[model samples]
Target: MDDAIRKAEILIEALGYIHAFRHRQVVIKLGGSAMEEPAALRSTLQSILFLAAVGLRPVLVHGGGKPIDRAMTAANLPTKKVLGRRYTDEATLAIVAKVLREDINDSIVRQMRELGGRAVSLHTGSTQALFGERLKLKGPDGELVDLGNVGEVNKIDGDLISSFTDAGLIPVLPCLAYDAHGNWLNVNADTAAAAVAGFLKAAKLILLTDTPGILRDRQDPKTLISSLNEAESRKLIAEGIIDSGMIPKVEACFDCLRSGVEQTHVIDGRLRYSLLLEIFTKSGIGTEIRL
Candidate 1:
């Protein structure tokens, strides 16, 4: 295809998405191995800016567990991983807050500024206590453990996030949250994103993952499931077909849908312009979980 024709096609498609999503809120859960890659990082930023420029409100909830692990190792602190979930101890919790909230959140804001979007950081602890719950995930020593100070989000201050959206500013969120007593807690980024989306009554929730989408066969990338309703998703989970790293994400998607989010998408973050393709193209590149 000629360059000008391709550009025109992309422009038209982007305009279509903008028209369809204007005045709608979208919560994006950014994670997986893709974010670590420079190209993927650039793509994600570009996509966010594009969405914002087109009048779609986007709230970015980011994960920094891998960087936290690396920082912990460098600091000679012990790290734990069980069932693909990180077990956060007191030390780990401190590190997580620093990395996710300060470092990662600030970096995203800086990039957004460069992308011509006004962005700011939102920390759960600083704003208000939006999550509370204790869950245990196994540790590196292969023993049953308590993930101290960890949290599962049960609430979100929609007004606070919405205020930013109303101001034409994108809210960049960290996975860390706090309890009613102001106790800091670590939360799964995907879970955090879903809770926020539900609270804000967002029109869409987009989860960027390493996989292409939800696969009928985990071993086969081409066996992607294009769409699924909430009940059918639960059936798949009951059958134990959704396992491993995909489990939490899939569950989060379902949770968001049940909580009244219009649409939830799980897409491959590795592909450049994957976000645009999924949102603006006729043939999307990921699984779309809808209510």
Candidate 2:
């Protein structure tokens, strides 16, 4: 009886949140070790389906870096990184496309269906919801550095995405987009999810990663920052507290905030039901960046 009462209390705690978020969109970016573990991935998908079941629309954008790397190795292609971003040449781009579209995206959609959720793949082969142009970068010497086949998102097909959500279906997208010249480009999944959130004016943007949000001490999990503002986040970046892969994730949050999204969160995806806890609980288990 005690355990049953506890379960009822949990539902009562979440009731207000469920009502508030009903019919509102939430964009989730899935990556890191969360995707590598089968059990964790299924748990995360179940949480997403729970969100959908309660009437909140959810959109998922995924990254397949580990899988892509393995695929490239099998193809005998040398993987290159330029300034923390993948330098995708023709061969590398082909493998990336294949892995993202055929493997990762399909697997996610199929798994969601098996979990009793309605999901549709929105990629270059499908509705092609995301579009962008080639991305160019610069080296330390201020000279142009070519990152072939990599691109940044510029436009999103919000209407098409809305159509899917309206029909009570979740839209799953890969980190691949088409350019105006009909070329496929590799995009960073974090930024891709942020762009989608911005275009849809989503109520929340959640990035599920390996770490326990942003910490003052990288080695200490207890030092996690529960809430952050834009100015403080930039100060931390300038102070070198936020660096490397985390920099892009923080910047993605800033982009979502600037575009009028209410809040953005970075949480530990490896934790079971972290998604539900972050959204439904009063004391969320992640760092929330708000304007």
Winning candidate number (TM-score): 2
Residue 168 of model 2, lDDT score: 96
Candidate 2 per-residue lDDT over residues 157-214, each given as its tens digit: 9999999998999999999999998789999999999999999999999999999899
Candidate 2's C-alpha runs over 4 A off are: none
RMSD of each: 3.2, 1.0
Candidate 1 per-residue lDDT, tens place, 101-123, comes to: 77788888898798777988887
Model 1's number of clashes is 0
Each candidate's lDDT (Cα)?
Answer: 0.83, 0.94
Model 1 TM: 0.90
Pick by lDDT: which candidate is best? 2
Score residue 238 of candidate 1 by CA lDDT: 79
